[model samples]
Target: MPQAVLDSPFGQMIMPALSRQIHANKRGGGILGIEQQTPGSSVKPQSQLHHPLAKVHVVSNLAQLDELLAKFQKSCAVIFFTSATCPPCKTLYPVYDDLAGEVGDKGVLIKVDTSQAFDVGSRFSISATPTFITFLKGQQENRWSGADPSALRGNVQLLVQMAWPPHPHQALNLPTFSNPNAEPVIFTKVPPLSKLLAKMGSTASDPAVQSIKTFIETRSSDGPAEATLPDIAAFTAIIRDSISTLPTDLLFTIVDLLRISLIDPRVSGYLAEEPSHRTVTAILAHVTGLPPKDCPYALRLVTLQMACNLFTSPLYPDQILGHPELRRLVTTLVSTSFLDGGHSSVRVAAASLLFNVALANSRRRRDGPGDVLPEEEQVELAASVLEAITQEEGSAEALEGMLLALGYLAYRMPLEGELADLLRAMEAGGLVLAKGRGLGGCDW
Candidate 1:
């Protein structure tokens, strides 16, 4: 029996007397042939186990029952239909409660006694006692009349499994492998969006900006209902021409707006599939600026964000990597920011961008006749990452990001190559020793 049943006011009045009788029977050498057990030596009851899940709600009225069902309407639910006079219900009560405790966040488990809530019984057309009804996303799924504990457990387990099936990749254990399905960065949090747009003044009324904004809103709300999206060439051209003339802070606003569209395949794919690759060209020119050093903090950060988001579609990064100039521009910007930027946040953002580049490159190599980074490119990036890591003083956040980027860059590189030579050089410089000491919890 459930502990709740034994703790009620009526139960409290009768349970002690019942327990004393049980104890007396045990002292009499057995109850149903079970041996007498001393206090504290008995088996731990299932009720005593920790069950962090929501408890089974015993609803007594139609309103309360409706409210309980409404709470988990979007999730899986199970209701134990019971009545006060049902003998099997009393037998199954503890089992149902235990199942609820085990169900946890996967679904909701509730109990309602038809004897107390006659209106609820009528609503569900309950004609029998101790019925179990299963619901998936507010719709009736399965129901049966009986109090078989194993069947109840099997059904609830199956419902939870259906709702949250295990991921296909969970069993694979590849430490350095990249997830090809990972989407690019989207700036979901638009703080003071109106203010940011207003900063552009009359330029906010530009058709390209308006089109980009509309596309973002539509994709967010309706999610690819349309067969077509805004023209990538037109949007990129407008932004490229405008970026050269915009103020530094406003540059961030434009890039921030543009990054959201990268999640749309129609838009991002244009940069990859177009023969001319005009959008990517515009991006590289805008990011590099007049002189590389002249790139504003806002532009650098937002461009890094854009670069990270480009990973949503492999084509963008793959296309950029195919072109020597574009690849050099991205590598230079990221390396400089990671190595020399005075701002810790900028370094961290740049490190993340580098990580994306390395991950994309690795994924491409694994897929076919692809190259992650050429031997020289790998060595160059690893050196820049190591320099940044060594110079980093106390920011664990930045250090961790740099270390991850380095891991991605070096994980699958040929052991006999330039990257390996670089690692050996780092060992000579005590970098390997520091890492070993750090892992062993020793002061470096």
Candidate 2:
């Protein structure tokens, strides 16, 4: 017998005639088990052990497979079909698992043992011991049968590429858009502690207020690591209780105190972890709810600065962006402050706050799958920034901050959404270009 014939599985069974019939059936598209390859196909046989870090879903039945497929319906998926006794199937296990780790949440990877999942085997007509199927957007895209690791990797990569094509913005020559400044623009200047505390009048005597004063003094002199945090619960209560009763002018004093202490991660983290974010929310709500004429300039300025300082804690950014009520109040305050014609400083501080919010949202998009700030809020913010950019004339610092914030918001944003439409409607690109000219050719 020929060596090819000797190496055939049928040779072991001593059933050459049966093997011939199977090959003929495969050529005629009747037998689904055998891999059909072109004469010059690049796929070659290869194998590997299962990868330790790979997160692969091993489904035992059709229901489990269905559930996984449904869960990742919009993403790419690869299903490996194999039997317990198949040696060739063992070879590609590691490659498949490694690919699962690489794909992560971008796609789904599944392995089904045909011996244990007879129903799954029948569902896909997986007759061969080691078969591979790829799905894109819930539809079957391709199928092959083999132990070829290279082929498996190529097909899966191609499916994922088709599922999530690169955004056109990614190809732009804008480096500023690509690399956002992760460091939030914060106001760290500490005014005289005695004078700042004296502004609080009778509240200055409260132990919570006094303790925070010491914490701020120590933090300013020795740095955050050396400073001990004051009682967060008592301080939060002080802010909550004072928001209602404190004279509007003196309210800025307490907020400034909170803002200074918030430079410490411990204080900011405590407020961030609060179930309702009640303390920060109360201050912002009370301040933003006031009519523009009634809201004190000192209070509003300190509030904006306080909002910017919240980003010092890694925990607060997500809460500020993720919590609906807080998100609304913060955005409202920033947007309202954007139109502050009298206080260019207030607008500058507001722009910094906006930049912090956009920076946080941009980081979320970069590190994860979806936008942390909802699309509607993004649209609202972009509109506010664009309006500020158009109206901005005197303060280049405020304009610079607004432009940076706008760039972060627009970076890697989906090109086919309401935001894209709004950008077009407002001719934001032209507005930015005009601002660039006025600013004597800004870098971004």
Candidate 3:
């Protein structure tokens, strides 16, 4: 009976659902003998257990009923259900048992056998067994003849609201900026975007992608010296939201943006919507404009193809060597960076460019057994690299790039004395020497 009462809110209509669960099992409805709860317990209902109803007495004999009602009158509610023979009537007893405190505040639930109290049922017009009629201050207020949990809760909410209204003037705890009156501002820690193909990474079949590809190819032939994108703030907004997700598609877009635009548009380190840059892919790119694709700007543009390798403009290697200006530019940037130690950011960018050019030179020298780089060309490449190391002298990033470039060269050029000495010098720089630093949180 207790199980039925507790579950009644969700399961009173179970008879119908039960028959549906197991086909043909749902013809008629009857009690499954759920456990009953005691009255005047902590298990009292949220509704009415605290209401002011009436109290009514139950007596099996007509003569005894008259005496009991006379003794307790003008009270809270009374709960009188059905006899043992009535299946549904048995379900209410457990409910009444656990929550009898209602007898004092709302009213009392009393059980009476319909067969035993036939004359009483006829007086109250009780047509069904276990019918519940709640009385308030000696007058009936509500009645429930069928079991419907949702319907029951609906009525309960209404009743509870009438008795107690929710807090009227309560305030919500919204975040308040320290400078609430400060000027309205949008954060600019996100990258710039080109409108030619927004959402390019997501819309796989979008028409914009084809249009942009065609535009790039056509422009490459003889369209414009620079394909300018609109200076729209919305593109910035798009990037701000995009980088926060740290989606790989967004990273691909970053790569594509570099490929399409010869210049590396500035990117902010954070988003306006978020307070942190924990997922940002490259801090150097955000702060110093040093993403892999942006390094060529520090070096002059070689031929379009070398420029592409240096990450200036997207061009294949074969096309770049054909241009004398680009070839001279690559040579000049590498030579000057080693000769003059200017800005650290520029130096870092310059070293990377040199590394790539060395690797390219080494590759060109290996095309055939009869081929060897001219002595002057080999000296230009070697001096360019050695100059970078000499200037950085001992910086970590510079040394690392030097080592990588040399290792790449050694693999291709089959090093002898001079190149071997450069390799030893770069190794002696010890770029990977920071392993014994603090174990605590980083300064960043």
Candidate 4:
């Protein structure tokens, strides 16, 4: 017996008279002798298929469709026009649902049964029993008829690809992505060892300090195979124990020796990957606590460079970003030195360090769940950059670096709390105006 035709979004589905169109009622009235290939002429057996990627929302009314469209105005969309009486539509149901699930947040998938959603079907001229329409950024991109599973899968996958092309960072091989065990930065020109030792004077006499200097000199001339690095555990302990008793000048010189020794991956990598991170912590404390005015320009620059060189070990950044005190120390140093235009090199180095920090934060955000840096930390960093930009005394390179640092810190941050305040501060500093002045590549 034929099932009673009732309310359906598909409205009366018409089909060609054919015995092959089995499992369907005979009351189906449409143009006779029309080719079975003329759309809605074939129905394959249904099977269970899983859709784990995304959910296919059933749009019940025009209002629901409008809401979905507006909500995903900036996203990709796939709308499935289905019918109640169309067996071919039912056959393709599993394939369509699976495509939706696979696309996830990258694309919005919707299913509308025309028998129950005539208004939506009429809006898109969807008179056929089963049709699929894809939209990119709220605009209709492609539409096709019939319940061809392969075609449905291909077009939906293509829509997802168009919506989210691979991230630009994937193309960039950044320092943060380098092997943790890779070699450290080596100064191309070696300074005279005698002069360097003479400058250190009394501190050079310390066994641990002297050993570090010897290792750096030997490593530079003879290469990693020939030079033996100092016992890093002993060196770290000695520095920690001796720093308390040392004068500010001697402490600064010792830090410089540590900087030079960092040219060897053995030294820097050990310090970076230490279980307690005591080496980096001690170094940061000494460097940040140094009397700014009394510290020689050379010592200051080397210290900043040493901080930047920490990227040699991939684990170093993860440690730094996760520690509040360490993050504050780096950000404070970067903010202050970046504004010190009188020392262009210091300012630039500071900018570079900030860039690395920002980049690290961005990677953390993308790599997994969890906040890269605390919201308070991001706000503080943003404020520092905003103050520097307001002064506008730095070089273009410094400015560029500062902007990048701010950008990373603000990327994907919630628009509330200090982050919101930071945005307002940036506005007050003429960020919008500056964007209008040819710095157009950034997107909020």
| Candidate achieving the largest TM-score | 2
Kindly list the per-residue Cα lDDT of model 2 for residues 1-444, writing each as its tens digit.
Answer: 222323434234434343343224222210111112334433222223222244989999988999999988887789999888999999888898889876766778999998888899998888896888888889999999888889889898888779777555544444454554449987889999999888788999999999988888888888878888789899889989889778897899999988988877777888899879998999999998898889999999999999999988989999999899999999889877877778889999989999999888887665444578998888777767777787788898898888878878877676656565556555566667667665543334
lDDT of 3 at 324: 45
Q: List the residue pairs that clash in candidate 1.
A: 184-312
Model 4 worst lDDT run, 10 consecutive residues: 1-10
Per-prediction TM-score: 0.54, 0.77, 0.28, 0.54
Give per-residue CA lDDT, model 1, range 162-219, as digits (tens).
6555332222232323344543334345445567678786778888888877777766
Residue 352 C-alpha lDDT in model 3: 63
Give the runs in model 3 whose Cα sits over 4 Å from its true position. Answer: 1-190, 193-315, 321-325, 364-373, 412-444
lDDT of 4 by residue, 309-384 (tens): 7765666777778877777777667655644557777766776777777777765544332255777666556656
- The candidates, ranked best first by TM-score, are 2, 1, 4, 3
TM-score of 3: 0.28
Best candidate, lDDT:
2
How many backbone clashes are present in model 3? 32
lDDT of 3 by residue, 1-444 (tens): 122222432234333443344223222211110011223322212222233233335667656655544433444344465776776655545555544433332224455666778777777788886676555445556777754434434543343333323221111111111111212111112233444246555642334444444445545565554543333233333434444443433344533432343332211211211222222212222322323344343222211112333223223232224334444444454444443344554554455665555444443432211113333444445545544554455465655555444333443333233433333333322321222121122110
lDDT of each: 0.65, 0.78, 0.39, 0.62
